[model samples]
Target: MIDCLTGKILKKTPDTVVISCGGIGFAVQVPAATGGSLPAPGREATLYTVMNVTENDVSLYGFATEDQRACFKMLTAVTGVGPKAGLAILSVMTPEKVALAASSGDHKAFTKASGVGPKLAQRITLELKDKVGKGLASGTGFASGADVPAPAGAPAQAVAALVSLGYNTSDAAQAVARIDEDLPVQEIIKIALRSLSRT
Candidate 1:
């Protein structure tokens, strides 16, 4: 199995990238965010990759981070979710948001993806909820983004506030979730911002 690829980017697109390693160019499909975050063509970059093989087809998918690759593995492990659908979900929502949605049982959040319907969205949440919860309880964030429950109330408001200030949703949620105790909305936002700024 190909664990990852590190090479000069020969081409980069929203859904795929061509990385020239040694004397070969490997074309790997990727989520929009991963493609967007990668260095421009000709620059050296690394992608955590998973190769999927079927009876007649072989495909490779890549991610910018190990967490994202782990997220993809967990997503595709679902009964009805395919590789395309998994990338679609990750393209729109980061791993942190996926964990947040599962933790809160917010199936509607995933409906924003292009091909994701309510039923599939609900299944995704239901299947991953246990994994997320167990990972949090075990203090392991390998697949899930956080090892804690998603913030709510003042913390939720703080997350929104951070998002409005141009922070990424994943970053905002994680920062708020890290604050163990409850605080006022302002305090939550303040602490979250401080946490985010440091990252």
Candidate 2:
């Protein structure tokens, strides 16, 4: 599976790098983050890699760390998100931010990636809400600390309040997940409504 490679860098471009290992040079597509982290040409570096194969082409993608590779794999699993788009997202946002956006249902944050529109952004967050953390590279946190982990399940009253405000049951639940459960129901509703309004 070519899980990883360590070698001297032979060439590099904006999103691609060629590393020479055992006299063979391998070309790999990389996210901007990985690209920026890579050492200069002639310098040795190690990359965690994934090989993608299809009907007519074989491609290799590399990351500076296994966590970023894991993040790449998870992002590509979403419907309508191909490797290029997945790389595009990682190019702009760190894995932690992506995980935070998914956990908090902040679809707008994903739209900052090139070629990611509102619908795709929403689908990415909605579909990954429960699944993202498993593969997320740990240690990535929002600098603002707004991506606080949520307690499982949503408070019924909070869900109801958001629903009454025109949010779907699922979205309301997702938004309410960001609030502290210890707070009063009214407070939960108020905070959830405010968070949803931002999305």
For each of the candidates, the C-alpha root-mean-square deviation to the true structure, in angstroms, is: 8.7, 9.1
Per-residue lDDT of model 2, residues 1-199, tens digit only: 8989999999988799999999999999999889999999999999989899999999999999776787778788789999999899989976655665786588998999999999999999978775543322222221122222222222545555565667765566566656676688788888887887888
TM-score of each model, paired residue for residue: 0.73, 0.69
**Residue runs of model 1 more than 4 Å from their true location after superposition:** 142-199
Against the reference, the lDDT scores of all candidates come to 0.77, 0.75
**How many angstroms is residue 119 displaced in model 1 relative to the true structure, after the best TM-score fit?**
0.5
Tens digit per residue, CA lDDT, model 1, 26-114 = 99999999999999999999999989999999999999987788778888888889999999999997776676676456788889877
Candidate 2 is scored at a TM of: 0.69
Candidate 1, residue 7: CA error in Å?
0.4
Query: What is model 2's C-alpha RMSD?
Result: 9.1
Local error of candidate 2 at residue 7 (angstroms) = 0.2
The residue pairs in collision within model 1 are none
The pairs that clash in candidate 2 are none
